[model samples]
Target chain A: MTDPRLTPLAASLPDTVPFVGPETQQRRMGREFTARLGANESVFGPSPRAIEAMQAAARDVWMYGDPEAHELRHAVAAHHGIAPEHIRVGEGIDGLLGLLVRLTVAQGDWVVTSEGGYPTFDYHVTGFGGRIEQVPYESDRVDTKGLIERAGWTGAKLVYIANPDNPMGGLQGARAIHEMIEALPQGALLVLDEAYAEFAPEAERPEIDPTDERVIRLRSFSKAHGLAGARVGYAIGPAPLIAAFDRVRNHFGLGRISQAGAHAALADRDHLAHVVSQVAAARARIAAIAHDNGLAPLPSSTNFVAIDCGGDGAFARRVMTGLGARGVFVRMPGVAPLDRCIRVTAGREADLDTFAAALPEALEEARAAP
Target chain B: MTDPRLTPLAASLPDTVPFVGPETQQRRMGREFTARLGANESVFGPSPRAIEAMQAAARDVWMYGDPEAHELRHAVAAHHGIAPEHIRVGEGIDGLLGLLVRLTVAQGDWVVTSEGGYPTFDYHVTGFGGRIEQVPYESDRVDTKGLIERAGWTGAKLVYIANPDNPMGGLQGARAIHEMIEALPQGALLVLDEAYAEFAPEAERPEIDPTDERVIRLRSFSKAHGLAGARVGYAIGPAPLIAAFDRVRNHFGLGRISQAGAHAALADRDHLAHVVSQVAAARARIAAIAHDNGLAPLPSSTNFVAIDCGGDGAFARRVMTGLGARGVFVRMPGVAPLDRCIRVTAGREADLDTFAAALPEALEEARAAP
Candidate 1:
């Protein structure tokens, strides 16, 4: 029998998704992998203070989270030198992205993202029935001009770009992105997803004037903060726009313990800096391993490195599959030239050594695969 | 300059929301209230085991939560005797509600709900641009036939009913809801929100099979489970429907500590039973208090009591304000009729005494206020 409650629009949408969790794949494969490098999650862990806060609050999980996310928002606002009115904390950037899509895009509305940018953002745009238009990455960087020109051409309402961009681990200077933000078509919003911002060179963070409308920068605790498991992300924008989240968000939806943990995490700026250093160190180590294996590791400003596989997408797929078969988890880009690379997250020393050992063997196996 | 990014449909939608959180009110009031009984959160809290599990796992916040929520889903499926594929976990019922709206409703899509059922559900539908068509409750029970008729009349793609419903705390037996579901419009989906199900009589729960594609059931940790701060909720339905969540949901969105806590909470059936019993006792005590105060408390199956103020919405508003002013943070219904009653959540004895002491005075003050 057909589902009777689905609207025509829901019915019309396809059931395909962008990424499947490694857990699902594990279930399918009936075994867990050894080196977990696939999803770009930090294996280094969160601050002791954040962890302690969550643990302490866990017993009190009986209370609903502070709906206003009061203390966390204040801490975040104070940290950024902006008023709390300028911030809205969410489940994650992914959650915020979905909410932003719902708030700003309607069915048949045009939303733009780079062809090989974050797939989750594109998923949100399409999920809300927004028609997606894309700009391919140029020289391993997201072409902000091309995105703006397309936005103007399609009259798109939203555009997504990850600074310290993902997969390729490229960077765009603050001045250029800020200039692009200013040039964005009137009425359109710039969604700067800075999931990897903590790792971005200091100069790469676009100097966002708090009063600037038409742009909302998304930040996450998942990367350098090492709280990926907490699912904390916030969007920074003009007050009126930030307030719109209240109009549509899951208000009492935050986890109380998670909120306390995030608040403490944000307060302990020292922890964040330490994690940042660890990430930089991991990146350097990962680059060395890729070079030793004769694969070219792209310059990265993020936690993960994408190693050019020296062949086509199919060859890269073979390499990824070979590693998986040997119990190492890694991911690859979705499209051509980009797909000729495999994305590996920075992990602990043991994990890195596993990846190091697996690479040459996997590459040889892929080269020999029929 | 305009927000060139927001869609025409988004531009048409208002930025104002129906619910302004109590925290925001607290901030506006410039002081914290002594008793926070406004939001119907369980103040007693979750099981110690659940708390312990979450706290213990807190330090591992660097690893992303299992995107599939594998362990948690399996636990829920086992608890309900359903296949793991039949359950979909999300941020919260509010978050699940948002996803369900997107899954079923589109702009101009017909959606049916009780006039003042759950405002959050309606909020989600409206956010997704669905046109809400409300039917009045009969004798405070959601007029099942009225909803079915409205669904058929408007060809509503989705219909929502909360058993042991919010605001009113009214209930309908499985047989009644089953019949309604049977006669529901072809292809019209039934959304049974059982947030308060643990407090509900077992007999009142619908015996519908989990694999039934025509319906979806939602349960929350925010209620009796007392993990409201954790933001864990699940939607149970057929494999195809559950699979649909993967098509759009943020895979790694659920937080690590939350996932661990919810899994533990689900496993501790004894704790759940204890909570259910305590809530029942509290509900009885709350009802008795309403009677002692010369108000008619609606018989409830949930954790809160709705005490009829023997007047109109304005009188109930006074009672709420009186309670608020005197440090008893009770709330009243939003719309008319139901607004004739003040809603009070079950709290500790001291909190109840505070309510008892504050009521008449608040009432007197309301009577004297211009």
Candidate 2:
């Protein structure tokens, strides 16, 4: 019997995870993947300095992490030239997103996002009983204008827009983003998820005014820093919104190792630049491979690329299955039209080679299978 | 202008944090404490080998941690002589408590906990909009009988009782806890937070079967393992309830370094036993000092001791202040009656010496403050 205490909302909601990890997929499949191209994780690895800092912090895990997150905040502030009050660090963008939802979302409160944006955000909204209004991605980018119009239509309390968006590696430049920001209804907080911002070209990143209270931006060490396994991400926003997080956040959620690793990673700009360069090269290679196969690879500004297979979702599903049977683990979007493509993460040359070797055979089998 | 889509429950709840961290206190004091004793953290520290394992994990922070958490679960299962399905590891006791509440407590759903119990659980209940009915402590031990009675009266969904309770380190024997569990109202789930279990005497720990579906127990690496800073904890329960966590948990919330450190720490029973012995000695020392100062030290099974300082909450506050002024960070309970005592965490010899030296003067000043 279900426990009597669960609220009606929690009780009514089905227990479901947003995205199953590739590890779970592997376990279910009863074998490991030949290439880990799913989940958009960096396989090139983290900075040497970051690794050193994390290793050093391993033994001192007994002491609670500094609750204020002072040193790391100072480092982030110095790096971004913002006061510590403007930055809020959390477990990851996912954890921060949950808190952001908690800060503003209530039963029946409207949350607007692209139909196929991050699923974790969707999970948090429903978990908190928020109503969601979706706008479809226009040509692989978050349809900002459509989003704004819908926000007005739904009178949403919060709106989420990920630049250099996920599922498909497409970006909305700073000018367009800034113009769209001006259109956000007052008191409607914009949650800018910049998990992939590091990969976006310099001109694409909007000039963020730290003192602006209308929006809160989230970034993570998980991607560019190669610290995805470390679970460290921070929200940058106006002092008030950032401070409001203190009122409800898991104060000691960040570990000593995570905090120390993030601080060290932030200081090691040399490694970050190198990883960014490597990722750029990998993206180019991935796009070229798609072109050679007569598939259309969307322009990517992030770690993953969405390749349009020029067919319906069922066809793409067959291709995904074919690839999976060959021990290549890849994913696809859940919505219509977007589901016409398969999404693959940028990995090392060896991983890509595995994907290349597996794709053709899988596609043929998918095409031939009943 | 806020998003109109928020659920009514999320909208009505104010953003609030359950505990003000020691680091925040340090920031407010404008100095770091020489003897960090607040927050009930173990200053004794984690094992040497566990540190090595964490250091090794730092090198691969770029990759996502194993979502299955296989290695860590296997270690815990073997260590406890239970099936792997019986375990669910999380960020810490605090994080797990929040999850448990989410799984059970709902908006206006009745829940029961001791008045002087851990505030984090209450925070979770409030966050989830559960209607809480607090049963006052009976001699600083969670009033188990009262808690059960309240559940029967209010049709509580969950009943939380921490054996080897926090703030006050008193404990009840296993038979008492077992009897309390048997008397629970129909459909009520019992959450036995054993965060301090390792420190409890062998006779005090309940021998309830791990496979029991009626109760879920919590354990952590924070105290006995000296990995409070690492943020690792686990819940033990029947397979079905444990499996349900998979539906809602952040799949990759636990970091790579922490998982590795916890695994290694669990394997090293020698280190754990050593920590237990040291804690016992420290508790005794703290109790003796309380006696010497003409104060009463309540019986303790956990790492900290709650000392009844002569006078009311205000005088206790003064003593806490004087001690803080002298760079010793101790804490007190938030509610009345309980607030009349000061809580001090067990620490290293140097730390205890500092606290012992400072206490007499702090008490004198507190007595004369009016």
Candidate with the greatest TM-score versus the true structure: 1
Shift of residue A122 alpha carbon in model 1, Å: 1.5
Candidate 1 lDDT over residue span A6-66, tens digit each = 5565565566667777877788889988988998887777779888888888876777777
Listed in order, the DockQ scores are: 0.61, 0.54
> Residue by residue across B28-60, what tens digits does model 1's lDDT show?
788777777777788777888888888878877
Top model by DockQ, which number?
Answer: 1
lDDT by candidate, in order shown: 0.83, 0.84
Tell me the tens digit of each residue's lDDT in model 2 across A41-125: 7788887877888777766677788867888988888889888988888899988998788778877788899998889899888
TM-score of chain A of 1: 0.97
Candidate that would win on lDDT:
2
Kindly give the number of clashing pairs for every candidate.
18, 32
> lDDT by residue for model 2 over B1-370, one digit each (tens)?
2223334554455555776677778888899888888878878788888888888877767767776687798789888899998899988988888888877776778889989788888877887778889999877677889999999999988899888888888888998899988999888989999999999888768887877767999999998988987899999988767766765567788988888889988989899899889888998899898998999998988889999997899999999999998899999987878989999998889999999999999999999986
